[model samples]
Target: MAVKITGSTGGWNCDFPRRQYMSPLFSAILLLLGLCLANAINFTTVYEWDKYDFVWPSGVNTSNEQIKWNVYFEYMAVFEERLFLSLEPFRGIPATLVWFPISGTSTAPPKLAPFPSWELHKKDNCDSIQAAKGMETDRDGRLWVLDQGSRNCSSKIWIFNLLNNDTTVRVHQFPDAVVSPSFDKRSLRDIVLDKTPDDNLAYLVDSKSENIIVYSRKTNKSWLVKTPGRKWVSLALSPIREERQLYLGKSGYKELYSASVTDCELKNEGRSAAVKLIGEWSYQPYRMLIDSSNVLYAAFFNQNYLCKWNISEPFREQRIHEVGEQDTDWPFTFALDTNGIFWMTERNDTGDWTKPRHKLLMAAVGARSYQFGTSTDLSLRG
Candidate 1:
């Protein structure tokens, strides 16, 4: 079943995810006198689902085990007004790359329609998406998807023009050597891109291989930045073009590291990138995102609450915008919208796999994506 989700929990789901109504605050002691706001640290639930409803194709045997198992969504990306999400290859997921229109309102839970079309999402079909794990979008109306591949396929990078009826614009499969044949080298944790260069460079972090894979759309090539012993799972790329930095977050480590995006690009510079320890946090960190305002938004692997720090400052708990509640929920997958709204989802799946314990929340933080720009459309959709 592939159709859009229009349901709203009343009047909450359709608000502008971004806004300019930032509260005034003063932190003069840190020299960022009026930079941080308290409203930026707290989030509220916009949509709640006890379990998701899929619009399945007609005549499909829903009783089949393969199509009747648990389904979990762990990756998300918001483009214009559409909130794109990917379900883990949890047996019953019919389509991994699906989306819902955030502007619509309905009483039932939103339905996720497969991107492009359901025909292009056929399982085991090499031409179709085998498994879509992570995704990121830019202001240019381009959606970057990381397909983790299946038995007869190899990991691939997919670029779809969201502005052009979600057309497939480019598909680059990673060569065996680039993704390593021996181990789970293609365990891509996340994907991010630098849209300025002609090469159209994109970076992916391999959680299993502990390396970063860089892909170039112009050259149709890819390379691995080896990290042999580390468990580098999450990564964030700076939006600052003048001085680009790719920040690395080790799964259970307290330190955050970085490397110059310029040095790790595709030109075959013949030199290994020098990794630098950018800063350290009180607790181990997980996923990360950089806003257009140059602030680093981060989630901890162990902490329930989220925090944000200006890259120019040290990543200390005392210096971050933190919510003091016994924050026990993690933003399983989150994305930033142009309106400075931080959207996150929390999933609580337990013994009863049938129960849906998922929530889509949003926090207007007074910042936008690193891509930097405003859309003419006042609505979340651009």
Candidate 2:
């Protein structure tokens, strides 16, 4: 007699002879079953906010009228156990930096706490960040803040050393050349840091200008790489493994564009070469992240499904899971941890935008973790 296990998909099936009790075929079948079970994806909520915990400084108004104003979270960065969040300056909130521990409380949901302390009038100063849209925590325990200069403020990158008491170590302001002449200020939406052996670089995306600005920390020089073909709504950097590539997502376009870091760094004065179209998707992604094995995870606009695309050969796009509802609004940004768990914020758009109804959620994307992989490669030939 023989025992046979058939997988849900037609491609996978295994058979074991009962006579050969502990044979290699039996062992392989057992391993395959274990792998299938281990790779199962699950979604779970880490933290939720029915309404934002607006804690103002002692002198500032803590009245319900003031706190009830709209405040939205656009981006987040996780370093160790601390989670850092940035508020978009849509409602003119004075405090921009808010953080809390990963292990949050249920009875008392994590309240938004100001980083570097909250102070009135600090919002207007160029030295201080007016509004930040995106942020990233590097391998060296340093946090990079991308201040978009939303309300007539200077666009700048503020680097803080989390290891050294969260002190500001470097501040780099974007020159006027990189900003678009049409807009009052460039919309610096997102940033990705590349700390390679030969070069230390930061790539910032100007959503309004449709350009990717590259900054070299070693040389203290900056340049621009314009998005080719179509305008990109968002940009994501692949994990530095064997090669580094930039992933650009456009709103209406079904295809995602990618380019090698080498081409992006090659300078013809202050501009780099345009990127080429790469993987095609069913829907335009709002945000995307690539893991160590080159698997692309994306969230789309007006869509309820979160998708994953295999960038390696035999390219395949699979809808991992669906979230929220077609009628409900979803978070514009999300992040992945070392363990492949995704952290995203969900807001209740059914209510007025002015009132806060945001929740921080987490979902386990995959079984394998990309924690040890380095994003330092740049092989981009298709």
- Report, for all candidates in order, the number of backbone clashes: 11, 9
Q: Using Cα atoms with residue i matched to residue i, what is each candidate's TM-score against the true structure?
A: 0.78, 0.78
lDDT of 2 at 181: 37
Residue 143's lDDT within candidate 2 is 85
Q: Mind giving the per-residue lDDT tens digits that candidate 1 earns over 1-382?
A: 2212122211111222122223332322122222333223566767878656666678866565444335566678997688998777776678888888777666456877888788978888989998887799876889999888887777888999989988999999887867755335457668888775465778887777656788877888888776556757788887647668888887668788888876534335223556788778766766788886677777776454566677767655433333323224343678887777878877664534464467777877677776663222324433
Give per-residue CA lDDT, model 2, range 108-224, as digits (tens).
567777775664227567677778767887767788888776455668878889999888888888777876533364667677777677766887777666567787777767777
Off by over 4 Å in 1: 1-40, 62-69, 182-185, 264-270, 318-331, 350-356, 373-382
Query: Which regions of candidate 2 are displaced past 4 Å?
Result: 1-40, 65-69, 104-107, 119-121, 181-185, 264-269, 326-332, 351-356, 365-382
RMSD of each: 10.2, 7.8
lDDT of the candidates, in the order given: 0.69, 0.66
